[model samples]
Target: MKKILLPALLLIVLALAACGNKQEEPAKEDTPSKEQGTSDTITYQSEEGPVEVPANPQRVVVLSSFAGTVHEFGVNLVGAESWSKDNPSFDSFLKDVEEVSDENIEKIIELEPDLIIGLNTIKNIDKLKEIAPTVTYTYGKVDYLTQQIEIGKLLNKEKEATEWVDAFKARAQQAGEDIKAKIGKDSTVSVIEEFDKQIYVFGDNWGRGTEILYQEMKLAMPEKVKEMTKKDGYYALSAEVLPEFAGDYIILSKSDTGDNSFLETETYKNIPAVKNDQVYQVNTAEFSFNDAYTLDNQLDFFIKSFLGTK
Candidate 1:
């Protein structure tokens, strides 16, 4: 009788343990899978609409102005447009990046990019989309910093972009305050670029550090530049009237190949800013874009040029 009772108790304990194990098995199955946590694609709310892109893009190709922004985000850039590749500041970073364009479908296809970025004005949109997840931005649709934030969203690096924008704005505004103190509260600045034998003056939103100087730094824009560039964001005029656009300080963005014979002219040399030695000359290649990398470089240049500090 004792042997039979002990065997029955043992069987009951073994059965209870089996039931407990079965209950825990379903809980494990109900939990999320590793594959579900790491999806290959994520939907991005682009300017055009929602488009699916790689969650962690390993290969990216930029066909327009966002190369610096993308590169600054630390994404792998397999290809970029000629302008970005030719930028002297980007030389070391883009040394291995292939030079591509909107028209080069075969070359782009060979790169096997998982993501492609460009302006809305690019050609062969449908063809590019067929090859990879393609996203395009309309120029000036958003402010430069906002554009960087948007790129960060696209790259899943919004936090980093937002941090950069906040820090940069503060730095630029402080620089502006320091410069204004040194120069004067009423001192005005003008951004002038020489391209294609034509001279142009820019407003706040235009590239060429105009955004940094007028928008971020809160520097005064010459009234003539404000009036002329108010309509087009930039105004083209002859070098003879360059003095009319001159200000207390001038940011001269010059292209290496552009005809800059005007710089040697008496009219240019005689301008108040030039004569006062307030003209800050920057290469168009280095100063053209408002991307983070370029903007930082521009800020450094301004600090060194204005306050004479590194």
Candidate 2:
């Protein structure tokens, strides 16, 4: 009985020792199921539920003023809408990209975009999805820098995108400091654009408004500018009320070529900006809310107009 018990104990000890000498978990299978991120749909937070995108969206279409944001991720955009000239706060190099147009929906469909980007309130999201997977963004409603960061997450380039923004912030800070020293601390500024319907003075909450108030030439925003928000946060005002919205200096944005000789109207001549030559007309189609290529132009424009010699 003792002999049998000793042999059994020896066998059990050998089995326990064998179990302790286990191997690794077969290198985790090297499969998508083992990955932390989703294998099917890449998820992103939005106004609605999680916005899902394909894993490797090769052909992409962008219809927002976030061309810089997408460009930060090193994505070779298959399609992009023309740069929005209405908001001069963004980079303008995007205008040179030959982006697609909403009017040419048939052309966009032919591109076979894997992902379509648009503002959260884009006109035809449902229709866009019928042609491709669309991701809606609340762009104009948020801060300019915030929009860039959020889009970074969507593109799975959060780290790289943040680096780009950090560089941009540095650029903004340096530009602001330089312009402040050149323009003098007492200087004030305003921005106005003539849209299809009416003239608009960008508000602090919007892109161009924020750029003037916070970036570029640092200046105090008048109370009238804040009131111009009008609930939805932006409103168009008639140029007749230029005095009401006018500041010590006004940066006027115009569509198409930079020539403003055509706008020598009687009313335009009387405005303090035009009268004193305090109004500087910038080419919107080339710069506003554009992309990296033209961002230097905006920065330079601020320097030349409000700051000093280039």
Candidate 3:
């Protein structure tokens, strides 16, 4: 009777151990099953169509001039185009990032980026695709506010981008009110730049702060200036005829040797803005930047230059 009782007890112990082992098996399977369901990538619909990009891209490469926007979004940038490299705000980032160009496909491959970004107008899309999943944006496909939001979506940071947009708009709107009070509500603001032999007036997009001076600040534009440049992004002018486009206030941007000594010339000096000392000369390379970082700096400049408050 004692031997029979011992054997039955042994069988019960084995049965309990088997149940414990079965319980552990499901936990081990849970992790891999989750991984299989949610892979490393998320599908982002690009202009080229839907493409799977790393959900959290670690190494990013930008093949266009919009690197500043990427950096502002707090992404890891391994490579970028050097259009804004000289800007002091970008000096630190440029130090660590490789300067990429269309001709430098080999260098891009060496960087081993998880993703590559470029303008839709960028060449070598097929070659770039061989390296990694690539996304492209059209140059004027959207305004600055919408473009940033779109970029955030592409990078899987939509919430962050939306937060920034809301905050920036609030600040910009307030700045606009201040500007109107200080500079007069009816005052017209003009954005003009000199590049090489050309003198051009700009519209609300691009890098001339038109969005800030005109759109956000509620500033008016000279009718002739508006008629000429409202459709085209810019209008070219001869030095002699610049007075026609001059406004109550003018923001002048000059590139290296691009000014053509126009500021010193009687034609430019005779403009009402020049005589009233309302023409603000901003660094062309600096002002040409239209990214999130540059916009913040420019807003401060407008307030100080026009409102005399820091």
Candidate 3 lDDT score at position 14: 9
| lDDT (tens digit, per residue) of candidate 2 on 1-310 | 1110110000011000001111122232211121125775577655555666766566678765555557657765777654432334433434444457655778788888887876653466777878877776443333445555566666666676668667766776677777667666666667666545356665443433345344433565666865665353344676566667776678776765333443665666776667888888765444344233334456667667665655
Q: Estimate each model's TM-score.
A: 0.87, 0.70, 0.84
Lowest summed lDDT over 10 consecutive residues: which window, candidate 2? Answer: 9-18
Query: Tens digits of per-residue lDDT for model 1 on 1-310?
Result: 1110110000011000000010022233322111212377777777666788887888999876677778788899999977677678988779999999889999999999999987666789999999999987665555667777878878877788889889988999999999999999899999887766778777776567777888778889999988887765677899999999999999998777889999999999999899999999988776777678788888999988999985
lDDT values of the candidates? 0.74, 0.54, 0.68
Which residue pairs show backbone clashes in model 2? 88-288, 90-289, 91-290, 91-291, 92-290, 92-291, 93-294
- CA shift of 188, model 1, Å: 0.7
Q: Which lDDT tens digits does candidate 3 get at residues 1-310?
A: 1110110000011000000010022232221110111367877766556777887878899866566667778888998765545455678777778888656899999999999987665578899999998987655545566666767776777788778878877888898888888778889888887765677776555465666676667788888788886654566789899999999999987666454688789998899999999988887666665566667778889888988876
Off by over 4 Å in 1: 1-38
Model 1 clashing residue pairs (backbone): none
* Clash count list over all predictions: 0, 7, 0
Q: Which residue pairs clash within candidate 3?
A: none
Could you say which candidate leads in lDDT? Answer: 1
